[model samples]
Target: MHQPTVQDFQSLKRILRYVKGTKHHGLPIIPGDSQLCTYTDADWASDTSDRKSITGHFTFMGPNLISWFIKEQVTVAKSSTEAEYRALSAATSETIWLRHLSAKLRLEQNIPTTIYCDNISAIAIAKNPVFHGRTKHIEID
Candidate 1:
């Protein structure tokens, strides 16, 4: 900001205008079922620049969308299943946090949280007790 250029000033002006335009907009939280559920997926090596996978997921408190995340994977995944498993892991973490928070807020989730993942191989890997050599490289917790 020491030597701000015209582009910087224009960008600032545009941001301020957007804020002013959406000042009255707000997210509505309606009362309904309190079950926690999440859906997650990832695209393996989708980024041509760095060849990193993109992880995306969204969580819902009953029928309402409560949380979402979309980001590039820190490490390159060798296979599609690995990439999808990574996304599932991230979503599971988010679900755990939300479950804890809900419990504290008196919205005790009696039912277990369900995480929906599209990749059958990733789901199988997660459920299997025995780990195979192919998934040895993945850091599982």
Candidate 2:
């Protein structure tokens, strides 16, 4: 942040272009129904250099895409399920923040936001916190 690099300049240019292209696009704020939904996924050991996983998620506000991101995980995940769980955790955090922000903005947000993840094993791990043999590594996480 202190020093701008070439990559930063290129990224800024890309953002400017995207903003210009979507200048007319705006999110609709409708009344009566306010719901929060999110989908999360991760690739196990996607980065060969550091063996780190990649986390990606998309958040929606009543069918409209409100937020999304894809980034390298801080720590390497031992299994695909672990990676997916990490992504789901991140999405859940965002969902909570968005819910609070919506309330602050006078939007009627319902409690208990929904988050979808593809990995059944990850879901199982989340559902049952009992540390099993397979999920021992991710227990502390």
TM-scores, all candidates, are 0.79, 0.73
State the local distance difference test value for candidate 2: 0.85
Score residue 110 of candidate 1 by CA lDDT: 98
Each prediction's total of clashing residue pairs, residues at least 3 apart in sequence or on different chains, is 0, 0
Best candidate (score: lDDT): 1
Q: lDDT for each of the candidates?
A: 0.90, 0.85
Tens-digit lDDT string for candidate 1 (19-118): 7898777566679899999999999999999999999999999888999999999999999989999999999999999998998789999999999999
Q: Kindly give the stretch of ten consecutive residues in candidate 2 with the minimal lDDT sum.
A: 25-34
TM accuracy, model 2: 0.73
Candidate 2: which pairs clash? none
Off by over 4 Å in 2: 1-22, 25-33, 131-134
For model 2, give the RMSD to the true fold: 7.0
> In model 1, how large is the Cα lDDT of residue 90?
94
